[model samples]
Target: MKRMKKVAALLLAVVMLASTAACSSDKSWAAKNDSLTVPIGSYIYELYAAYYSASSQTGDTAAGSASSQAAESSVLDRKIDGKDAKTWIREKALNSTKSLFVIDRKMKDLKLTLTDAEKASIKTNTDSSWANYKSTLEGYGIAESSYQLAAAEYSAKYQKVFQATYGKSGAKAVPDDELKSFFEKNYTDFSYVLCKLYKTDSSGNYSASFTDSEKKKAEAEFNDYASKISAGTMTLQQAADAYKSVDSTISVQNDTANLKTNLQGYPDDLVKLLDGMKAGETKAAEISSGYLYILATKNDIAKKTADEMKTDDGRNNLLADYKGQEFSDEISKEADSISGVTINEKAIDSYDPSMFAAEK
Candidate 1:
């Protein structure tokens, strides 16, 4: 649980950097179309999270070093994707926030109220998950109302979108075969042991140079570990457990529990590497700054049985995510096209990243 919290905070920062913001003393920003009111506090919290996360030289600090070291699909800097980093962040936040409003409006337009089970979900973070969250936020002196409002906004947006896209108030779920087919092409379930070699900043920028000695040193260390795995002497779990640090030593810092194939930030080269390998096989590929020796635990690219799809619950869940993503994408495109989103300078101008550091 402690470890999960650290990972959550770090990832939250990454998500913040990768994506949000509004301005005003009220800590709100408005969409010109009167569709949404973006929360300034959450927006700034995300910015600071990303800022401190990336600014750290090493993830060695329990909060950061390891958190930033996960293997991804694309290790590219998005700030250079066309717009500047700030612009990209703002655009994504506005679109996402507005999207929730749009979805919520749709729900009302349809005159739909969530079922009992659905309403119960709003208290999810507020209870045990939220208890911990509230305690942590209070430690930072953040107003309870601020984050609460943000959570409510997220809940309303998410639930409505899920209902509209996948739920039918009382509709029967799709058949298992149909879901299996959808899962087969669009989804994959796999676990891998990643050996990352790069020293990236919070923003994912790589080092300016690498020396031959460094390359040889990295290769020699990785080879030793790879040989152990190949010889079937040391398991990936054992490897990951033995050495948690990669910079000072080669270790299993990350492994995939699951991955959505079509998701962004997955390295295309790594995907290609994993594609050819079968389950329980170990393969090595030299990445930008280091070698990645992966053990493919489950390769689900092959067709799944009707049992694997597990019928309605799993299908509905995936469908919610799928439809939510599609809706988000549509909204993001619209956000990109929108002009003149107003931000209040006073609301978040004096923000500091250190205030919200997690309790040790």
Candidate 2:
């Protein structure tokens, strides 16, 4: 009957509509492997991060403008490290997403599970971030779940993998002795009292250089303090305190520890001098083209007590420095070896980095 044919046609139309909707959803996935499915939103999150990272490296401050036209043009037209900015951003996002996938796969292979504390930390961090940037992130089409997936969850997984590979009881643990040797060779611990040869105005602005007599007096005082410290009559902290009392312009940094050989703030000559000095040795150095003088004393890191090493977890930082690059290289190797990764170019091309640039 005609009525029966009409009903069958209507059912077929409904089925076709359902099928199309399902296909549309599938197309929204940015990537996937046998065991992992990366949502489009997660890919967008990676793109967002890559965009900002490139912007920061190229010093493209205008990329964060409210005007989408300006921000998009600025970012799209830029070049980074000999590559087009848009291309760099896309490649970085894709590679970073693959890295995340590798991390997840490795974590599963290694039977690694985040601790309850870590889970709570991730939730707390994600919740805090969502609270602060909910509107801005949502405006970029990043859902709360995708932000959690790409940010805190991804970070926690990476940390877990790093620890499993390098922790004290890890399968590839570096021996304590080796770590210590690396620490001593690559790190420096020292304290200093700085005497500025420039005078300050009432508002504490640099006004004038010290007279030759003032410079000589400052140098003589620092040399005397260095002598006292070298003689063991005054500790470095005691000398710093005493110098500050005498010259109000003096700045004292006591027990500054774990400074790498490439020390910042201090001049290159001073860093070279510090590198060559032994523990318990005190020296007076003219830095900043003789505009300032410092009485510096190098400290022995080998003598750090267990309790002292726990202070600020200096030991952990040292371990990170010693093994961080090696661990990263290993992760990159494993990530590259992973097979069956498929990226949805259509889904990726649907979005643009400029879409995120309008966000503050």
Candidate 3:
């Protein structure tokens, strides 16, 4: 009977050991599943995570670097560092999340309510934006799921913000004082010359399109204008107006800050040239489309009195501080309540140019 009792006791110990091992295994499985969930509070954080995953997986920082080095398509690059293009979906996702958060919080503060129409507008805008985002990503050979994930993350994060802020009120009208201040701060002086050149593009080479002969003549004219200003023969405004006589439709507006609100795709070189020159200065810039004559004009803004300036500055500082506080409060609350947080290290390391290779 004692021997039998010893055998039974041994069996009981084994059973208990097995049960403990099973329990531990179950816990690990649960944790792994939980880690697969992504947080939905900030698209920026999601993008950062995504980029980190890609960067970690490929051991190629060049994926991101290639984007930065890209001149026109830098918009598509997802580079975290160096010369790669930063991913637009990731960046916009982060921005959308932040914007939604801010808007939602504002609604809560103002006790505003969102109407059905407003909600519809928001939904429509969101849908449109996502569609554009996906299309753009596809053009660069990025996976559709990746783009969808980005939009999803942004939607989830901003929805929470909307619920809290403008979700109730929809769109809020800008206050007069606020609008005026924004306008004044952003408004600046600008000038441009409109020219009509007989167009020609040769062998699909834009440079070659402007035959060497025509280029020489245009360059000479540009130089003549530049020399006139340097010699004080004519001001930028005078030169542009004079040139307009050659082509009545080719009027030049010099030393003006306000551009038509509809002028899209303004050349960056023009902006830079304008900013670099004095009010009376003239510069000739060559663009892919055609030759441009730009003139700089003086800008005069009304300065506030010392006291007034102080008051304005102080108000701005206070407003900024309040915004910071509100954002922190809202984000902290959501973060604490977030259910899933993940970091995909392997995916990030593998995120280099090699990923762009044909799938094996």
lDDT against the true structure, per candidate, is 0.51, 0.79, 0.45
Those runs of model 3 whose alpha carbons end farther than 4 Å from true positions after fitting are 1-113, 126-187, 194-213, 220-272, 278-293, 296-360
lDDT tens per residue, model 2, 143-252? 88888888999989987887778877788887767876776666677778788888887887889999999889888988998888788788767776777765665565
Report the CA-based lDDT of candidate 1 relative to the real structure.
0.51
Model 1 residue runs over 4 Å out of place are: 1-80, 115-117, 127-142, 167-178, 187-274, 277-303, 320-324, 334-360
| Residue 254 displacement (Å), model 2 | 4.4
Candidate 3, residues 28-56, lDDT tens digits: the string is 11111222322232233344444445454
Screening candidate 2 with a backbone cut-off below 3 angstroms (N, C-alpha, C), the clashing residue pairs are: none
| Cα lDDT over the full model 2 | 0.79
Which scores higher on lDDT, 1 or 2?
Answer: 2
Please provide, for model 1 over 186-253, each residue's C-alpha lDDT reduced to its tens digit, 9 standing for 90 to 100.
55555555655546566657654446676566556556655787788877667655545554344443
Candidate 3, residue 251: the lDDT equals: 57
Judging by lDDT against the true structure, name the best candidate. Answer: 2
How does each model score on TM-score? 0.48, 0.77, 0.41
Over all chains combined, what TM-score does candidate 3 have? 0.41
